[model samples]
Target: MEMRAPEEIEIGQDITPPILPLAFTLSDSSLHSHCSSCFHPLNPKIPKPKPNNSHNPVPIPCNSHCNSSLLYCSHHCRHADADLHVSSGECHLFLQSDTSTWPSELSQLRLALRLFLCFQKLGFLSPEFLVSGRIGGLMSNREKFDIPGRIREGGRIMCLARRMRDGRFGNVVGESATDEMVLCLVLTNAVEVQVSEGRTIGVAVYGPGFSWFNHSCSPNASYRFSLTGFIGEPGSLEPGFRVTPCGEEGTFKAWNGDEDKLTNGSCKYGPKVMIRSIKSIKKGEEVCVAYADLLHPKMLRQSELWEKYRFVCCCDRCNSSPLTYVDRILQQNAANHSTCLDLDHSLCVEEAYRELTDCLDQAITEYMSSGNPESCCEMLEKMLIESSKTEQSQPLEPSPSNFKLHPLHHLSLNSYMTLASAYRIRALDSDSDKDNQLEAFELSRAGAAYSLLLAGATHHLFSSDSSLIAPAAHFWISAGESLMGLVKSSKWSSIIKKSSGFNLSSLLTQRSGKCLLLTELELGFVLRDGFDVVCKGFLACISRISPKVWPFLVHGLPYLKDINDPLDFSWLGMTARHEAQALIGGCECEGVAYIEEETIWKGLVLFALHCLLYGGYLTSVCYGPHCYLIGHVRNLLYGGEGSSLSENVENIC
Candidate 1:
């Protein structure tokens, strides 16, 4: 049953026994009835006759004799002896002195009567009072009366009427006599009923300002009802239970499974019940919940718990060093971000296959080096899947029906290309059969790599710059030509797509501008070599194709001054001189061709010096005169002596 406030309450009449008049002798030697402690008159002052024995001891008034001695009849003496009456340490009343201080004897009596009513409400007292001998010449009664109404009106009664009954009143009489009186009254008025079944035990719903309870993560109490055992699975509840009433609802649950498991259980309190740390707390530290999970991280916990609850936490877990805390977090972050490797790197494959496989492995490793571990693992797994498909195809035997290149085919192709280039250069200088076979295999591998690179380049063309396409085209053409020179016809047709399908026209057009510039530079060297080979005459081919190649030659002449190789420059210089003289003889009869003439003359001078810098080989027909012409051209290009051009020319010479 729900505990509710009593609508009405009754107090029985005082059952105190009548005080027997004491015959006492005062200092005057007169016999009189008086209080033993206060020495006050025992009878009311209304009309009692004086005692006949004038020689008896004189009676002293209790009011006049009451002093600092605790034995006196003052309320202070009752307070001093309060500790003796309580069994559980000091009474709550003594601790709450400011609220318990009574303004008068009547007020003190009223509080005591309230306490008696509370005990009666709790069923700790009988309805009838067990009175004893009384003092102050009064008889006391504890029979039934209107307890609630009398208490309500007791505050207005004067001293005579209040003192006429028991010396106790029924109303609080101090400034501090506010809600505590009402709270006590309410508590004492409610009847406690017991429930036998259900998850909930007893619940106390406090009004506003009653949520000041603190929390303990390892709580001291579990919820229990008055009649039933603690509400939980069997064995969860322990005997001899006592609740601290100081923690949060969750805190209680943390201690008991039944309470802990319920989502919207009866225990619904405010954030005040949350327990927060007052200092830094480290991970893995035993966390103590103040108001249960009231406060979270220490930074927030300290500000909130102190500001709201006014308590500082000194728990050991809340005092972790900052450096240690940071290091622990960083370690955790690293662990959470690591990738797991599954494939064994020791697996065997042919040399070409291994090179490609290694490239794929390196790419996978780099991609997974930073980020979430699960993502890195996924990426590496994909790489391994691709590696497995392509690691077996490079041997001399043909592949089976199930064979396929790895999905990470691009990375493998790039690796193959790099290795083939290295082998090709190596084979050019080595004479061993092993080297020759290796070079042949490398050329075939390079052809395959170029095919793969071209496919990727085609896919990237729309998204990337046109310049990127040139490398793919150049490498493919070079590799195809190399494979045609080395491999059998059957293999060449398979690896090299027919030149018809490939857009050679588009490729050549795209390369024309850059090719023209390169050829012009190469031609200047070929001329100094006296046109010994068609390769050296590559510039003449450019000039035959179009006169537009002439401008690139003029632009490249200034850069030739810094060339370090005398032989290379000398070859280039002779080629340039021949080309210039040919252009001059063709255009000399037309005065309108002077602009072309000046460009031809500059190319000639640049080429002549290039030839003279090295040991110029001479023909018998024009040997002496050629040397004289070379010397004359060098002096003119360098400017008169002691000038910047002469200085540069001298440095080169």
Candidate 2:
């Protein structure tokens, strides 16, 4: 089944209204931090770190008398979720001390329990939910994962929930067929509920309005979750969308629950998902959204989709004859001194595809689980530079002659993002020490360099694929943040003043013409210019300003010294399309040279403003101006961090 556009849809237009989840759950990790219902932060007073990583999942507990780890952010949230929580037997499942369940499975398990209870209450246990290969009109995909072990576990969990509710604990077998179906349905259709700031707090299973949209490598649509959204009317925003099952006309199915019962607001409190067109769509075109990370190469994307969704994506991007340019660059590796490792699909599988991802992931996970940023920085840098592969024969000394990752390789991108964050945290750890301020400033400088590199490299790829705009927006905003942060540092001003006879304070205090230039640019005008024009100007601006500060940005960072230019990815030399870049006199031959600190300050500031403006523009197109990234950008340009979006959105222009 797939959903088709009812009418021609322009970019950024909503394809679906804010659809409420039929069943939802928070993972065990966020149990204490976020609300069990709306998934809001439990304590706004605690400083939340600027969002960097995109997929951090956590757990939450319901606000009930049950002995569960679930917590609520507010009394209102708790009240709204009361019937769904306590009456659904979900409050009982969390009370179990089953430390044996894998953390990854905990979310689906809890959600399956919640969904089963709701299904029973709503009389959805009929063939519509149980016997058919569908649950509440969403594909169950039970056949793919209905192994005896999975079914047994599902039944065991189902019985456990019952036992917990009845104040008893025992190993007893019960009617588990329906429970297994619920688990399979959730595993098949649940989408992660990621917040505006890019944290995956929970999962939600929506009806056919969203679940019917099929998967694609280069999708025309994308979705976001709004926890504070009010579900006043179901299907009220029904546009011209219709669901077609197997290319045949089929009635668009919505949950037929009583309006009064639904409007009572028992199940409307969870995150509400809104689907928007990321690309222009024709009236009859089938709307598609990515089910897996689009940044992944074809092999990994296929692997992920098959593993999670039980199907291969036959999208044009996936079926490209010689592999898409983006896919080629993603898998390209530098072996034996800057030589591209050209591997076909067979070789990619044989190579185990980025054997270093496991090692790099371990280093990153260790840092995330523990609070040692310095160690993480050292470990990631060594892994990226050395590109080590551990052999069972010689685990310590002998080299296996492994290949280094291409800058745009998924692993390399992950490493750069982690390094940028780790370095930022390292700088913050020492920012309070007066004596170590210069060292901290250097760390900040390095962090900013990686952020710039990440943004430029990703944007360079975004030129080939418009679908990458979502992530490109994030990288650009993050880059502007790191750069502007360094430029605003008092320590930065002191160093520039002492070394180059200029105080950056004037730039801050004089209310410079730069502010006027930024505010004068309207968002509507930006979208009118189209992404291509904005991208062209953005790359040109970065190329012009970055050379002056590149050396200074990477002054003390050994890992970054090798890259000649961040934006000029002409090194790949994949296609002649780069001829357009010649108009800007591409910075491929940029020499590593630093000017005085004062000049560096000016260059960094100019570079940061361009990044922020361009980044904000792309973000508005992808996630809208009201996104959390816009607020961060707004706060940097004006000191209006916590102001309402309506009041401050105009300044974003």
In order, candidate lDDTs are 0.26, 0.67
lDDT of 1 by residue, 261-297 (tens): 1111211211111112212223323222233221123
TM-score of 1: 0.15
The local lDDT score (0 to 100) that residue 435 gets in candidate 2 is 86
RMSD of each: 44.1, 7.1
| Candidate 1 residue runs with Cα over 4 Å from true position | 1-410, 423-467, 484-653
Model 2: per-residue lDDT, tens digit, 183-206? Answer: 778878889888756888888887
TM-score of 2: 0.83
- Top candidate (lDDT): 2
- TM, every model: 0.15, 0.83
